[model samples]
Target: MRYSPNHKLETKEKLLESSSVSAKKSGFATVGVDGLMKAIGLSGGAFYSHFSSKDELFAAIVERELCQSLARLGGHGEQDCARLERCLKHYLSMAHVEQPESGCALPALGAEIARSDILVRQQAEIWICRLQESWARILDSDSLAWAILSQCIGALVVARMLATADIQRTVLQSSQEEIGRQIAGRQQAICK
Candidate 1:
């Protein structure tokens, strides 16, 4: 039976959402088209209706996930340093470290993203640069913005790799402390 156009759109949406979460939680390269389709209650053959290939879906996922990261971490163009400070605190928190599927795609999928085709990598670059630009405006220093952005993503990856919560917390706290020191040294009271 033929479904409504809306049904098709909705199914595609569900597939993207579910598949992205699955990819983030368990590297995208690990799952097949059939598995991704199954997560959305569709047959593997139906995958062609939404995307030409898994690579196409991956590009879409990269765009969707990074767009979300930009929105969450990039804040409005208000130049409020505190906005980034607050975001950093939560970003380096245990909750984010514990939830790969629901957190930023960078740490969980960065390796996979790096290995993806040029187009997917470019899509990630666009959003990442946008996020950096947002922070650069707030911090008034491109160097600091890049450093903090890299540090935050790295800290999360480190925290998640440890086998114990104490060590994970330490990794996060150290990064948070270092980030605080960096911001303070460059622009004292900027985030206060």
Candidate 2:
């Protein structure tokens, strides 16, 4: 039997939601059609009704995952610097880096995206744009926000790659303090 439009849309949304977390935790390439469908009480054959192919699904889910991270990190704010600080602190904390499944996609799936297909790359750019815009919102300058995002992402990626918790914490704390100072200095200069 054919499903209604609403049903089809709902299925697609569920598929994206389930697959987003799975892809984030297990890398997009590894999340099989069978497993993904099974997670949402559907079968492999039904996937095509929602997505044309695995790459399409990956693209959709990646966009969603990045958007979620951006939102979590306070993507938009008028002047609540404290909220932005809290989000950054949480982002770079040892807990965030230690858990790939529950952390930002930048550190968790950066390498995968770098090596992924064009569709995924395009989605990655959208994510990058979101982050850049989010940072600009906090710093009030497009360049400064992009710079801070780059530094934070780079530091988190390197820190997560380290073999020991101590090194990871060191990287986290050090980057956090340095970035914090930079942001404060920028804001102070503006105030002065």
Candidate 3:
């Protein structure tokens, strides 16, 4: 039975959406196509109709994940720099760590991205560059931008591993406050 082109596209989107969420939660390598399709009320046969191979689907999922990861960055403007800092602070907080599904793909799937294929790596690089561009606006120097970005990534990665809510919150608060204080110092240095 042939479905309309729209229906076919919708089915494909459903597959991508489901797979992305599952990958973010359980790691990309662990989410099987068959299982994902089954969860979305489709069969393995239909999976091929939408995707050439798992690698192709993974690239698509990575792109989707990347978009989701950056959606909170908002538009760049005169005020965007401040907004971006707050957005990053919010993202790296304990609230985000406690809720994986709603946060950036990095904390949820960074390790998996490291292990993924070249295509996924390329996609991740594109996302990172875009983020750097966003971050560069608020920061004065390239080195400062890289430093803050790395600190945010590392803090989130470490914060996610703590066993208790209090410990996790403490980690997030300390890391964020320390980063903020450093940014303040750097900004002051830039003016002097």
Candidate 4:
């Protein structure tokens, strides 16, 4: 059977997409190479054809996920404070909390990213910083941007750790409220 030249690139793209979802839904370390390949309807050995090693695949996933996160939370250009507010609301909602697989990769895979090699972590940091910068530009305070970003990610982590939906909702609501206050206060301070 003959395959188009794009077939290899297309297969790698599919593998990355499937593996990323699996890694975020579960832990990256928990899912083996064979499992990742199987998720994309490929054999374990075929994984080597796409990636030199599992670590390489992980690096790719980090880049892909973070790029997505940047696009979602970070406005393309000329974003306003209102857009940032809407983003914070959506990011801290129950839907995001319940859907780890489809949600932000940071809260889902932060621990794994922390444990990975320097290269992977460096890639994550770049995207994270871009997100922070986007928020900072809109908020007009770098520290405020960092605080809200950390709180949002931490809120998701804490909310997911709990067993009950009500308590999870409480955590998310409190964080959002506090963040809203912070933003409002910043605006008031600017007016004063």
Candidate 5:
């Protein structure tokens, strides 16, 4: 059988996509290479053809996930406060908290990434900075961006940790309101 010139690239992309979802749904360290390959209908042996090792796959996943996240929540050059508000609302919503497979990778896999090897950690740091920069540009304050990003990620983590829906909602709602107030206060001060 003959494969197209882009077949290898396409297969790798499919693997990355499938692995990313699995990693977000279950921690990267918990999902073995065989399981990830099987998720995409590929044999375990074929995994080595795509990635040199599990750590390499993990680093790739971090890069891909963070890029997708930034594009989704970064507002794409939007400088208005409304962009920030929308990002916060969507990021802090129950849907995002409950759906790990399709939601932001940070809250889903942040701790694992932190404990990962230098390569994986570096990839995460690079993408996280891009996310923070997007928020900073929108809010017109670097410090505000860091604060908001930290709060949103932390809220999502805490909300997911709790067993009850009510407590989760409370955490998300409170963070959203408090972060909104802080952004508004910053905007007001800038206008003064």
Candidate 6:
């Protein structure tokens, strides 16, 4: 049966969406093409139709996930401090940590990307730079933005590794407060 171009496009989008969420929730390397295809009600052979290889699919997923994450967390039009604060609150919350599939891609899949091919890693680098620039604009200091980004990503990674919810919350709360203090300190200096 020959599917229309629109139908094929729709199917491909569905596969990308589902595969992205699954990869974020569980490391991309761990999700097999067969299982990902099955999740979207497509045969394993259909995977090749959308992507030449798993690496290609992974590159696409990285690009999609990172763009979505930036839109959600980058705080496009809000004031600088407010945007930074909002991002910190949402990113460091227990809810974000608990729902890896729907959360930021950095903490969820950073390790896997580090091990992936140049194409995938390049995609990750592009998004990371975009995020840093977004934060830098709000924070008014590229150094501080880099620090906050590093801290936020590291905190999430550590929080997720802990055994208990209480520990995870502690890690998140501490990082959030610390970042907040840094921002506040900078603002105060600017006001003085």
Number of the top-ranking candidate, with TM-score as the measure: 4
Instruction: Write model 5 residue lDDT over 1-192, tens digit each, in one string.
Output: 999999999999999999889889888888787898888888999999989999999899999999998888787784578767987898999999889899999999999999999989999999999989988887888999999999999999999999999999999999999998998998898899
Top candidate, metric lDDT = 4
Worst window of 10 by summed lDDT in candidate 2: 74-83
Q: For model 1, what is the alpha-carbon lDDT of residue 45?
A: 99
C-alpha displacement of 55 in model 6, angstroms?
Answer: 0.2
Pairs of residues at least 3 apart in sequence or in different chains that clash in candidate 4: none
How high is the CA lDDT of each candidate model?
Answer: 0.91, 0.81, 0.76, 0.92, 0.90, 0.89
What is the C-alpha lDDT profile of model 6 across 52-143, one tens digit per residue?
A: 99999989989999999888767775757966698689899998889999888889989999999898899999988998888888777899
Q: Which residues of candidate 4, in runs, are more than 4 Å off?
A: none
**Tens digits of per-residue lDDT for model 2, 15-106:** 88788777767787887899999999999999998888988887787787788887787555664667777788888887777676777887
Model 4, span 68-146: residue lDDT tens: 9999999977887777888889999899988888989999999999999999999999999999999988888999999
lDDT of 2 at 89: 88
Q: What total of clashing residue pairs does each candidate reach? A: 0, 0, 0, 0, 0, 0
**Candidate 5 segments exceeding 4 Å error:** none
Ranking the candidates on TM-score from highest down gives 4, 5, 1, 6, 3, 2
Give the C-alpha lDDT of model 3: 0.76
TM-score of each: 0.95, 0.86, 0.90, 0.97, 0.96, 0.95
Candidate 5 Cα deviation (angstroms), residue 137: 1.6
Winner on TM-score (2 vs 6): 6
Candidate 1: where is the Cα deviation over 4 Å?
189-192
Candidate 1 local accuracy as lDDT?
0.91
